[model samples]
Target: MDPRLFLADLEAKPAALRNLASILTVGDAWAGLPAPVDRVLLLGMGSSRYAAEMAALRLRAAGLDAVAEYASTDASWPPGPRTLVVAISASGTSQETLDAASGYAGSAPLVALTNVPDSPLARVADLVVPMHGGTEEGGVACRTFQHTLVLLLDLAARLSGEPRDVASLARRAADATEDLLARRDEWLPTVADLLDGRHGVYTLAPAERLSSALQSALMVREGPRRPAAGCETGDWSHVDVYLTRTLDYRALLLPGSRYDRPALDWLRSRAATVVAVGADVAEAAAVVRYPGDDDPYVRLLTETLVAELVAARWWAAAF
Candidate 1:
């Protein structure tokens, strides 16, 4: 992907989000589903799957039976009239998702969330909910990824019986994205330096917002071809903590998890560098804050911009 085009794609995030907000205001995107939705099965790959996983977790917390599966999986829930299968692919041409979704085409209601409404995936869907993320031109999934999360959050609200003003949340997310973009000169340099360790970048977030961590790391690797990884904050101590002692560990911390303290203790003890986003932490070498960060929804929707910008910066430099 072209780095300059990627930066341009990121620059358009606020406007794209505002457009999505307006779309949500007009009508419910999922209104076309069949009568009963007893179970939810979300299928996707890459960023689509990342957003779906977070949405599935929220749905389960709301006491609904929901699961996000890799579209490549050989087996999944059986097709049924009461099942709602959401096939998400920004391009609407992910082969695995198309294959998995085809299984439920007639028996279960298939909903396609895609940027290209007329794509092959939409052809099989009973309902086509456009992402409205606009064209990336950059050949990257930045805008589509954010739009996916926002739309999936809306879906979670609908199924959970929770009346969330998703449009308002999208508006706030736009503001936050604009704030970050406007102030990039203030924090990008410091964050880039802090996270530019020899080993690579590590991203950590709470279970609820783990998608942020995963997507952030993916941006670094996808754009810059860098070595990067993501981990859940609580699970860090058990799985990733050992690397800090032997490597020059640098991390982007999305601070919301209650278990953050334990991971911070290890990082501090090992003298690892950290750049906190959306929330201040004691051990962070730098902290990036913006408007609407206090709201968890806003943080979830906006925090990944830090890594994305950093990725863009590094990628541009290399070329």
Candidate 2:
């Protein structure tokens, strides 16, 4: 299937997010825990793990005590009561996630967010949040990752007793996704042109956009068949910046909360080609602006959609 068509199919994300929210809310009701659960544990790997991190932040903002652990790491440790384990896997069959779920002998309830309800993770979960990305090709997760992030944001809101607000925010995110998809033909070609001959790429972002950067790097690797790495903006400023100058690398900056204007200017001064993907572009070599509220979660979803479409365009042009 063509990559554009595959990306267009991501429009089902809103409904998918709503369905997952309903399931989680109903499960919370049915679980009938003496009180709202206080502690939460999230587990996954790769982009799935990145989604867990974003979910942890949203959960924390919503007043729930949440933490994320890579599935491999979580599998090595046992969970305890009063903890809710949320497992995320785009394919629902991630080996590490499945192993973690099976190894978790603790009494805490398990919730799964996945595209396949019948897959291993779902089978072991006490509650399953089904993703709307029906099927994927080329082994790269574009739509699935975006949808999972949206669902997790909604899940966090639901758990925080703000279901209505979460739904509203999701709708806006879905709208932003649609807008980017509509204009993909124009922006993606530019992205493809920018990344044309680069043998390697690096994605930079703050903690909030860390997942976006990771997903962007994965898209470049899987879709464009390029070597890509992602690093936090703050950390990269200290260590990776010198390496980037040494390598004369092209950087894709998914500016997060920690984005320092002076640092970005300095990188530009070093002649690094920095492409900014987000609402406002500052001193970027190229910019792919996504329309949406400034909420990191919402912007992250929009940015991922735009970046994936651009990567898909590159993939199509290459192959």
Local accuracy of candidate 2 as per-residue lDDT tens digits, 1-319: 4655555455555555455445544554223332457688888998988888988887788777888888887343346666778888988888988888766534667878788888888888777777666676545676678777767776666678764455455566767776766676777777756655455778887887689888888887777677888888887877777765577677777776555575587677787777777746667757776657466666876676655666777777777
User: What tens digits encode model 1's per-residue C-alpha lDDT throughout 87-173?
Assistant: 999999999999998888988989999999999999999999999999998888999999999999999999898989999999999
Tell me the spans in candidate 2 whose CA falls farther than 4 Å from its real position: 1-35, 61-63, 74-77, 162-164
* TM, every model: 0.99, 0.85
Which pairs of residues collide in model 2? none
Model 2 residue 29 lDDT score: 22
Worst 10-residue lDDT window for candidate 1 reads 28-37
Task: Please give the lDDT score for candidate 1.
Answer: 0.95
- RMSD (Cα, Å) for all candidates, in order, is 0.7, 3.3
Which candidate has the top score in TM-score? 1
